[model samples]
Target: MADENQGFMGAVWETIKTIFWALIIAGVFRTLFFQPFWIPSSSMKDTLLVGDFLFVNKMAYGYSYASCPNIKIARFGIDIDADDICGFLDGDNTRVLAGEPERGDVVVFRHPVTHQDYIKRLIGLPGDRVQVKEGLIYINDEPVKVEDGGTFTEVKEAQGPERRFPRCSNDPVGEGGQCVKERQIETLPNGVTHSTLNITDRGDLDTTKVFTVPEGEYFFMGDNRDNSTDSRVAQTSFGVGFVPYENLIGRADRIMFSSAGRSMLFFWTWRSDRFFKGIE
Candidate 1:
């Protein structure tokens, strides 16, 4: 009986050790290489969907305080933010072994004030003047090229875990009906082109004052121009303003998986085409 009990206890210890090591390795991997992200809104529209799942390439722009993983489990009463792990690196707005991010790059960063993670396209770099006029973007007094790309359509139904309904240019859409938004292809000064969606002809953000991006900061905007509350709005208003360099977490390069249902276990809702789909 003693031999049998000893053997069982030995197995339990081995299992516990294995799990502990596995978690340690995963934490290191997530901090140094890639961190998984899920799209929870339509801000990026056709580029990223509500259920799109992708890994942020942490090495794409090197490491910063924002590179540290923010773990928050309310039920467990656990809340660990980036500052908790790398507070010493904060406030400097610098990154170790950093590479410059180009205009039009889709990036994920921590909100300057709230410290919450947000994903958007980099629009203005340091010392650039950015503005939106009549739903068109202008950089340093010159407008970027915008070409009509037709309409983007989706079902007018609650989506994802949030159960949020998509805003549409053609409103009054009944549930299960087709919701549409006008799509336009925008080309930045660097010649990078991406699709932007318009839900209304006149949106509050369609026309805004020229915002001069300060040095060591960046301006970002959502692809869903009308629906996004981005750099166009001030951070004090609960919108993402100019993000500091240290706040940038990483770049999003591709979608590894996606699901349209509330739970990922609902295999029938999986989007097969989005598997390994590269983000442009």
Candidate 2:
């Protein structure tokens, strides 16, 4: 009987060791290779949508302090930010084996002041002057090419887990009605073209003063245009100002999976078309 008990105890110990090592491997893989990111807002509409789930390529721009995972689960009262894990690497604004990001690449970076993760399209590189005038972007006094791409339409209803309703150029749209926004294809100086949405012709951000990006910093903007609070607004005013290179976490390459419903568990709401869709 003693022999039987000893054998059972040995088996349980082995099982525990296996489970422990499995968790360690997963944690290392997530930290060093890829980190999962879910689109929680409509800022990158038409390119990325709410409920879209993708893994950020941590190795694309190499490792930085911002590459550390920031886990925040409100229900569990657990909040661990990237700074908490890699604060030693912060302040220097440098990445190990850093790679330069292109002008039009969609990037994920930590807010300089808030330290929160934000994803937007790179607009201005270091030492570049960026400005918006009459709903058009001007880089170094030269207006980038913009062509009308007709209207983008969607249902006027609560979307995703936040249940937020989308804004429309044709406002006053009732629930379940068609919400519309003007779409325009913008070609950057580097010839990278992407669709941008405009909800209003005369929004506050439609025109802005010339912002000369500082050395080692970058300017970013959202594809949603008037809806996003990005580099156009200063960090002191609660917007993402110029982001430093080290704050960059990674690049978003593609959408691995997407759902339209409030919860991902609702399999019927899955968007199969967006599965494995490459981000332009």
Candidate 3:
């Protein structure tokens, strides 16, 4: 009886160790190479939909200290704070052999004011004069070539907490209402083309003053024009404006998986068409 009890306890201990090591390895890989992110809003609409799960490549953009999590915090490694970590830390210029963000790259960064995670397309780079006039984007005084892609209608139901999202909706008018939007393909100066949705040609953000992206700052905007509160809004107004280089976390590489968000156990809501889809 004693021998059986000891064997059972040893087996449990071994299982626990195995799980712990597996989690540690996974966490290290996620931290160093890629991080998974979910689209929770309609800001990116036609490009990246709600419930889309994507992998952000950490190595694509150079890493700051804030991008690297403290491994010591997990109690798996030794603690070594460069600036004396006291339960909180700020951005430190710690480049770990990575590249810089480029124009038209979809990036994830920490919000300059809220410190929350946000993903948007990199628009105006350093010193770029960006402006939106009558629903058209002009970079450096040259209008971005935009071609009509026809109309887009959202026919799906909202899932998770996004059901309460009071932005552009599938049922725009009301229940059983038609949600129609104008679709257009906008080509950036770098030739990176992505589709955009416009509820109307004349919306609040559709007309804006020329934004001169300052040095060491990048401007970001959502593909869902008229709906997103991005670089178009003032930073002091609680909107993301001219994100610093240090705030960038990574570049969104591809969509790993996506769901319709009706149910987790129900497999019918899975967006199989988006599985392993590459993000443009």
**Candidate with maximal lDDT:** 1
Per-residue lDDT for 108-202 in model 3, tens only? Answer: 98777666678999999999999999999999999999999987876534554457343443334664355678889999999999999887765
Which 10 residues in a row give candidate 2 its minimum summed lDDT? Answer: 235-244
Task: Name every residue pair that clashes in candidate 1.
Answer: none
Model 1 / residue 208 / CA error / Å: 0.4
Q: Show pairs that collide, candidate 3.
A: none
**Per-residue lDDT over 152-228 for candidate 1, one digit per residue giving the tens place of the 0 to 100 score:** 99999999999999998888999999999999999999999999999986788999999999999999999988888
Worst 10 residues of 1 by lDDT: 232-241
Any idea what lDDT model 3 has?
0.79
Error of 2 at 67 (Å): 1.0
Q: What would you estimate as the lDDT of candidate 1?
A: 0.93
How accurate locally is residue 170 in candidate 3, as Cα lDDT from 0 to 100? 37
Candidate 2 Cα outliers beyond 4 Å, as residue runs: 1-8
Q: Evaluate residue 93 in candidate 2 and report its C-alpha lDDT on the 0 to 100 scale.
A: 77
Error of 2 at 118 (Å): 1.0
Instruction: Please report how far candidate 1 places residue 76 from its true position, in Å.
Output: 1.4
Residue 189 lDDT (model 1) = 99
RMSD of each: 0.9, 1.5, 4.4
Please list the C-alpha lDDT of all candidates, in the order they appear: 0.93, 0.91, 0.79
